[model samples]
Target: MRTKLSSTIFLAILACLLWASAFVGIKIGLPYTTPLQFAGIRFFISGLIILPFCSQRRDYFRLILKNWKVVFVITLLQTFVHYSLFYTGISMVPGALGAIVVGSGPVFVAIVAHFSMPDDKMSLKKAGVILLGLTGVVLVSLERGSLSGEGKLILVGIALLILTNINSGFTNIIVAKDKDKVPPLVLSSASMIVGGLMLFLFSIPIEGLHFSAKPFEYYAALAWLSFLSAAAFSIWFTLLKRPGVKVSDLNMWKFIIPVFGAIFAWILLPDEHPDVLSIAGMIITGSSLFLLNYLNRKKIVR
Candidate 1:
């Protein structure tokens, strides 16, 4: 049991760290292409990247067909609606604001699961832990400096980001509820392919055919983003399907994203540097995770 618990924690952290790295990659790639088109290509390639591992199962295509309805729903919610709002919102707001909003995702997911899942209902302890994590996120984001921008546009962007969180919560519930019917690889691959294709086609009309000759760094960023997306989503899907895993509890791990995101920014982006607030935020966030695990182990919260 200890071994299994350790493995789950390890995998969850691995997925979150992989996702965090996308912050640097996206920043690098966005200058060369439109947001939707870049995201589309990244996810489309991500689906293809997972294909070989999936091919090991001879009946993979058949499973995807059988689970097409759920796949379609997931594609719409997870990729289409989620990223559409995400990219649009992030573009409108400051990056620090975007990071805080994205970091708050787990809170929304917890609320959604509380109402949707019988066994995953919220508790005082869980709510406290989640808020504590969000506080850490806010501190980390504020380290970048105060927001100085158009108020109305920032509000609108924030609203869109909040909606993305709600959409994500619903998507996660669907995945958890349907975990038994669809294999993780099939669900992830099919949804990413179909949804990514839709985004790419949609972008061509609105964003226009803007992909042009670019430096080696752009391609490198794209390649890294694609690979990380494939691996992270695959790991996440498998973990979500594990027996005894609760949506809210599992999602709390996402609080790690911004912590690692800050670290990655400091390391890779020359403009970024470490500071006291980020370190404090990291400590607070880590404490929340520890509190959550302690509560779970003590059966202090359900």
Candidate 2:
């Protein structure tokens, strides 16, 4: 049991790290491609990479046709709406700011999971840890200055990022409910394919394809982002399949995203630099995850 738990924890951390780097990757790629177009390409390649891993590969289309509605709903909320807004939001918002906004994903997930999932009900201790995490996130985000009429576009992007979190929360519940029926790899890859195609089709009129894998850095970003999605989604969905696991519980790990995002952005982006407070915030954020698990474990012991 300890070994399994440790492995899961390791995978969780790896998933967080890859996801955190996505902020830098998107920033790197945005110069070469528009937001939706960028997302489409990223996921299209990602889906192709993971599609072969589905267990029932022979019955894939039949499975998809049978489960088409579920696929549509999941991809619509999880992939299409969530990421379309996310890519757009991350495009306009500064990488650090974008990371902070999306880092609030756990708060949204925990709240929804508490109400919607009986076994995942929230306790006062859980609530307090959540608040602590949010406090840390808020501290990180305060670096973003006040909004102005001239900065309305940034505000719009911020709003999209906020909505993106909510959309993600709802989809987590949906995926939790359907985890048993659908194979995780199949679900991840299929939704990615359909969702990527949607973004690709939409981008045709708004932002015509200007894809070029030229310049090694640009190609590397695209390739790495694609691998990140495939690997992270596979790891995440695999863990979500375990008995007694809760989406809210898994989501606490998301706080690590902004922490690593800050570090990676500081490393990759020339404009951003980390400070004492951001480091402090990262420490606080990391503590909150342990706090959450400790509280939950204590509850179980009782």
Candidate 3:
């Protein structure tokens, strides 16, 4: 049991870190590829890579076909809509800022899960912690600059990032409620496949399917990020489907994304640096992790 618990924690952290680094990856890769094209190609390869490992049973295929409706919804919300907003938005925003905005998704999940999931209802204490976290997010977002010129795009990007969070929250609840015969890996792979294809198709008209990059670095980034997406999605779906796990408990780890994001952005993007407000916001944001679950003392009985 101890080993299982430790492994779960490790995988959860791994998923968060992988996702956090995706901000930097997207920023680096965007100069060479269009947003949708990059995202489509990235996840398309990821889907292909992970699907085979899902299973060999024929019924698994039937299961996929059987629950195609749910799969379609998941594909739409989780992969297409979410990543469309995510990739496009992050391309315009600073990596750390994008990370901070998207990393605050747990609050959105907590609120929406209250309405959608019976097991994960909200409480006053949860609301308090959410407000605390949002306050920190506001601080970090404002630290970027005034929303006048390029800052306007930053603001729009921030809005898109928030929409991505809301989209994710809705989809997380949907996935948590799912009680089908398919494996999580199968679900992830198939959804990525269909959604990725759609995204690439959409990219054709807008970006014209053009791709250019430095010989080594472009392919290197593509492979690295594609691998991360496959691994992270598999691990995340497994964690979400695990018995006795609450969305809040799992999503709280999202806080770690910004920490990794800030660190990577500082190292990778020379123009980006965490100033006083960003640092303080991270501290407050990171501190919200402690104010949840058993640590949150509330009178309401669950």
Candidate 4:
């Protein structure tokens, strides 16, 4: 039991670290690559990496054919729409702010799951926790100056990010509900391939098949994002398969990404550190996330 618990904790920590590093990686790579090009390459590479690990090609194809509708919806929400908006938002907003906004994903997921899944019923306790988590997100967003209209375009970028989070929640609930019916490795790989192809198609019009970055930074970012996607999603899906792990529990760790993003900005950008008010805001957000997690855990155990 102790060993199993330790392993779960390790995987959770690994998930957090992988997610946190993505913000830093994106910040490092964005200067050299356009958002659409960057997302396309990352998804393409991720699909390639995941292709080999799929258990059976024939079975995978059958599954995709049989479940094309659901698969398409998941791909659109999880990969196509989520990445397009998220990358665009990341490109426009500060990395820390983007992380904070993305961190609100669990709140959206809980709400969606409550309405969509009979097994995932909503409780007053869980609802309260979700509210707390949202409070944290709002605080973090405000601290990051995401609430202010830095510019009209940046404000639009923030709205895009909120939409991205909603899509993330949709994807998570979809996977959690269906992971037992479908093979996760196959689903993950196929989604990436289809989604990457779709993004490639879309990019032709918006980004025009451009590849104009120095070999070092551009390829480096692609590599980082691909690896991050593969590692993070694998562990995330694995955890979702575990019984009794509420979506609200996941929100507790969300704040870590923003904290890491802040650290990354300080080290890499040097000029984007939070002001005193921002620091205070981060504290409030962090506390709220903690409270949400605590309340959810207590409810789960009782």
Best-matching candidate per lDDT = 1
Candidate 1 runs further than 4 Å off? 55-57, 300-302
TM-score per model over all chains = 0.96, 0.91, 0.85, 0.81
lDDT of 3 by residue, 21-77 (tens): 876787677778778988899999999989778774456568779989888999999
Which tens-of-lDDT digit does each residue in 1-302 have in candidate 1? 55566688889999999999999999898998899999899999998988888854688778878878898999999988899999999888987888899899999999999999999999998999999999998888878656667869999999999999999999888898886898898888888888899899989988899846999999999999999999999998888888778999989999999889889989999999989888899999999999987877676323
Query: How far is 194's C-alpha from truth in model 2 (Å)?
Result: 1.4
- Each prediction's whole-model lDDT (CA): 0.89, 0.80, 0.78, 0.69
Backbone clashes in model 1, listed as residue pairs: none
Residues 258-287, model 4: lDDT tens digits: 655565566666556666655665576567
Q: What is the model-wide C-alpha lDDT for candidate 2? A: 0.80
Error of 2 at 241 (Å): 2.3
lDDT of 2 by residue, 173-270 (tens): 87778867778888889988888889889889988878555677788899999999998987887787776677887888888877777788788889
TM-score of 1: 0.96
Q: Candidate 3 at residue 239, lDDT?
A: 84
Runs with alpha carbons beyond 4 Å of true place in candidate 2: 1-4, 91-97, 142-155, 211-213
Off by over 4 Å in 4: 1-10, 88-100, 134-147, 150-158, 272-302
- On TM-score, the leading prediction is 1
Candidate 3 vs candidate 4: which has greater TM-score? Answer: 3
> Residue 201's C-alpha lDDT in candidate 1?
92
Provide the lDDT at 80 for model 4: 93
**Candidate 1 or 4, higher TM-score?**
1
